[model samples]
Target: MSKFTSILARTFLQCRPMTNVSTKNMNMLSLMKSNSNPINRLAILSISDFNKRHKSSATSSLADKELATFLQDEIENETKSMETKATSPTFEGFNTELKDAKVILTKKSGKESFKVIFNVNNSLDNNSEEEYSEQKNVSDNKSNEDVELGSPISKPTYTIELEKNGQIMAFYCSFAEEGSYEDGNQSSPDSAGYSDLYRIDEISIYQNEYTDDSYSVTCDLLDEQMYEKLFNMLEDRGLGNEFASKLAEFSTAYEHKLYVNLLSKIKNFISS
Candidate 1:
């Protein structure tokens, strides 16, 4: 079998095939969705509202809209980074100068995982073909599985934010205790265990060009202690568990439009 196919078979790159629900199952889902609990009811309502908005405007689904917004933001950030390098005396080439990047944290069911965004330094790239090759090692730790994921992650613009970030040292996806974390592209997390520290260099603040929000945090020189600090920060704000749970559900569930709403809501909720 081809190396690429081998990785797909074992790695987290393969999304679980979504199965169609039978008519009886659909009825059960309807019944469960009608719970009087505020939280459960809101979820159903949000999903309905999300689909309705798309139909009303004859536009993309909420999930698509969110994905588009994320990619657009990534592009804008990457372009700004490139512009700085082009004007700099030490500027190298486009391939070396990373415009934008992202890393998704993976965990099993009921675990907390999230995604982080960062840019790159073109000067730092080793420029090896293997660095960006289709046969490159995937971030999975269960085994030495190979999958394709370099700059821009996937060919589709919408998949840009899904790219895992790296430079000299590189980044690996975090794993949960013992479960599948499809959202983070991490498989067999339980078997391999999780990494505490996610070392990154040359990180910087995300320039809020689209909005007037003050978010100046350069994770430059982030160390092991600092990684723990992030979780502590979330915990201090009392959003650590909630954040992880929402992310897990969003990653595995088939109807993602509702998760988009949840993500936006969480973004606003925590940012406030």
Candidate 2:
């Protein structure tokens, strides 16, 4: 055999599986080679084997590419769904001013807490015939004039105060609630109950850090411009009237209670 033929045979023998079928094929090919030109025969065999292996590798690469594309699409869809869920607002409660309002708070070591405020609007229709009839009857009765109408109205306003170890340090009005509508119930014209309404104009948070004998406190409330923008938006969207006022009153009371509790906790922590 030629030197080139000898080298090709050795290379093929090392690479092919050592099986009876491969051995038979090798023997047959060797017998067909011309004694003087065995190099050509070996070249043909090498070419055929290379073509088969190249085709198999090409098919495997195509399948891998398809699988990768499918996986990529699934990952992208899941990421979009997670983002939507994170941004979507969830209703916190109902029948109160703070109801359906979203609250987000974040705090880090040595950093002040960050708060995001969400606007909440509630509406109720009172133009029904039944409601009109009731109001007409009350207006006609002189005895009902002195009786309280609707609900009590508290100032939809709040102040932020800093307390350390059970002592007040500073106080300031930071948030004020605005009424959407005046109470329309028939009652004494001068009675305060006729002015009851729920409104939550703004929310403010008081943050404090206490040491052994001293504390640092800060108050952050909604910006005036932002609050005005929100108020305008609600009005434009027809979120006015007595129902909105009542909601504001309830929310103010609830928020006040929450502030008190938070202050109490801080006092206890410092004392301990």
Candidate 3:
């Protein structure tokens, strides 16, 4: 799985198809991994069954409206839109508009399944500028700025498996390599220079269970090396205390603090 974290989604397909899922139980072994460069769209292949439940709200309760307003204001005017479909579409015959998010159906085995498209806002440029500015300022005190890392390709779409009861199953999160891209003259990172943003190297989610990208395994679930790496990343952000507090809530077996902290610098949308 460590090898998976460092490669592109294309690499995920290069190897021969496995008899069983490559990752313990992450069913999404076949994937385009969903690209973000051109535009965000999630298409599931090989699913044998699916059902869609669509609902759109033009009017809402005060609380719902408030939450919607809060999310909009929180994203620096980025609305983060999503749309849901009420029925299944044919194989390669989906007819919905290209949207930030949409609901669709697919089939697997003899049963149907539902998939929700979660559109992750692209923050590569935002993160790059912030990191570069901070590092450049620090270097100014010494002598000159020397930032090496270039912006990363952000995962724009997340196709999450949903249970009949509407519980989340698993989602595919593909990331791009650091320095794999540059400003104004971008090129594909198809060959090498790819990496995982959430640090999981494979398609499998931690424990082969229901957890969003915001959710992560408990300390015991991670090996010493991965644990230490995540801990260090948290330390750099002065959120070691928050991280410790999250782990302290022993009953909350799945902790999402580190991911939420890194992904949502302005808000904890996952928990919300």
Top-lDDT structure, candidate number: 2
The lowest-lDDT stretch of 10 consecutive residues in candidate 1 is 153-162
Model 2 lDDT tens row, 1-272: 99999999999988997566687777775667553467877787799899999999899777766665655565554344334322322322222124333322222223222222223222112333345567556866967476323321223233222233444322221122233343321111233533313233333223353245553332224454554454444344333233244334444344334433444454444334
How well does each candidate superpose onto the true structure, as a TM-score?
A: 0.20, 0.22, 0.22
Q: Candidate 2: minimum summed lDDT over ten consecutive residues — where?
A: 106-115
Which of candidates 2 and 3 is the stronger one according to lDDT? 2
Which ranking of candidates, highest lDDT first? 2, 1, 3
lDDT of 2 at 28: 75
What does the lDDT come to for candidate 2? 0.40
Candidate scoring better on TM-score of 1 and 3: 3
lDDT for residue 83 in candidate 1, whole number 0-100: 40
The window of 10 residues in a row where model 3 has the poorest summed lDDT is 79-88
lDDT of 1 by residue, 70-160 (tens): 7556555545533432222211111122223322232212232223322221212233334554333454432565543443111111101
Candidate 1 vs 3: which has more lDDT: 1
What ranking emerges by TM-score with the best candidate at the front?
3, 2, 1
Deviation (Å) of 265 in candidate 2:
48
TM-score between candidate 3 and the true structure: 0.22
